[model samples]
Target: MRPSSTLLLVLGLSSTLTACGGEARSQASASPVVETTVAEPQYESIEQFESAAIKRDVPYVPTPQETVDEMLRLAQVSRDDLVYDLGSGDGRIVITAAKKHGARGVGIDIDPTRIEEANENARTAGVTDKVKFVQGDLFNADLGQATAVTLYLLRSVNLRLRPKLLAELRPGTPVVSHDFDMGEWAPDDHKRVGDDDIYLWIVPAKVDGNWQWKDAAGRSIVATIEQEFQTFTGTARADGDRYNLRNGRINGAEVSFELVRAGDETAPVLERYAGKLANGAIQGRITAGNRQAAWLAKHD
Candidate 1:
């Protein structure tokens, strides 16, 4: 028999013959003294084992509870909110949002171990009805139903997710992150908790391209807008005159700017425009001098 088979047989015989006579003991002792060894599990490295078992893009790191509170606070989570937490280790952020703010939440984690732990945590927190833990890739998870989002991922991961966040989330949805910030895409608010950093961003509406609206005098007003994230600069042409856009800013779907006739800095005529962007049109009001009128602009 092979050495392994011999080892198993010997072990079996030894157990059965323990109460046998001296002859049996002698027979067993005379049998081959086969040396056996238990081979230890082999791995290339600790990292390899972790990679195979966890398959996580970022190592599991739990955000501090205080930082979690601050993140929800920064996002202004409320009962009306449905928060989605990506790479949600232990599901603390979403659970806290549910427990304290009365918000419903979803947590996504790539690791099944983490998802299990997060689900158990939610159960212990008595918020299982308000939150759920999903084992899935955060990159492909559906976020369209979320009113608020939270992240505790690396900067590279956040960058990879930036486009998805913008594409899937509705304008005015709040996104809060711990430690890392979306590169180049600045946060609307930031705060420091203990030694950790918390950041908040309000999803901005896409407002690039030409926008056209007529003034009260019924002259044709065509404004060309150039947008980079939430800030934009553009020029408006009405009749045969060109005007410059100043202080152009977009907060969520809300748009505000000042239109000044070019080269009229000495006593520039300023038309302050404020509006909400929806569909392909903006609807709000324009203020000039002491007169205010409905402002409607459509993207062209």
Candidate 2:
């Protein structure tokens, strides 16, 4: 006989429930406190990529493959070229240079992820042996090793990189840019690939040192030369007088300057210097007025 109670329970229960209740105790002990591990979210390297975008980013838009081929063509890239691509998005430029032209190259981009993607792209292109990619700022990237430099940066970035390009790249090294120009330093050549514009520049020789050379009459022309990239300005001292140099410019190995001899200046004499710069000397032909004579200038 059962009495009414506050607790609610069936008096009789299952016969298969382990007669000693051993199964319930075993189950309770088996279920120890479970712990889980959460993998930390992968973050970009602070040394390689900034948490916030810098002014340098020109967005991630890739240059068309056809346009890239055109750039290489216009630059006249050969087997001797060591092409360097600034802001290399997916390494297409350097890969193309290596695969298509058999040139060695390096692609640089500040974003680490972009560099990873670029390296993968290079591998897929089968140019991994010829080209490599790095993560770094494009503005400060080393340009000395490059025989040809490629750019797809904005106009402002182009202007910012112009000095480095002129200073580091060797004379006659071709620099090709897609879309943008280097301010006043005009392009040596231009071409259109489909609807895109490509510009090229041949780095001019450094004529920024003091030179001593003789005129046609052996005038002992000791000239002071100062250069800013391709443009130059300085006085040519001869005949106990200083002559001002006008229209002074350098294009690759080509140099030209108009010299006006002091007060008797009626019209400026055009002096065209065509020579090979080597052995710390500018040795070539100097054409002035109606006379064209052999000229040799030694760095003083």
lDDT top scorer: 1
Mark the 10 consecutive residues where model 2 has the least summed lDDT. Answer: 1-10
RMSD of each predicted structure? 15.3, 20.9
Runs off by more than 4 Å, candidate 1 = 1-51, 263-269
| Cα lDDT, all candidates | 0.85, 0.78
Can you write out model 1's per-residue Cα lDDT over 23-111, one digit (the tens) per residue?
66577667698454558667776644544576566777788888899999999999999999998888999999999999999999887
Instruction: Report how far residue 237 has shifted in candidate 2, in Å.
Output: 2.6
What does candidate 2's lDDT look like per residue over 3-23, in tens digits? 221111121232345444776
Off by over 4 Å in 2: 1-56, 226-228, 241-246, 258-271, 288-292
Task: Predict model 2's lDDT versus the native.
Answer: 0.78
Q: Would you list the clashing residue pairs of candidate 2?
A: none
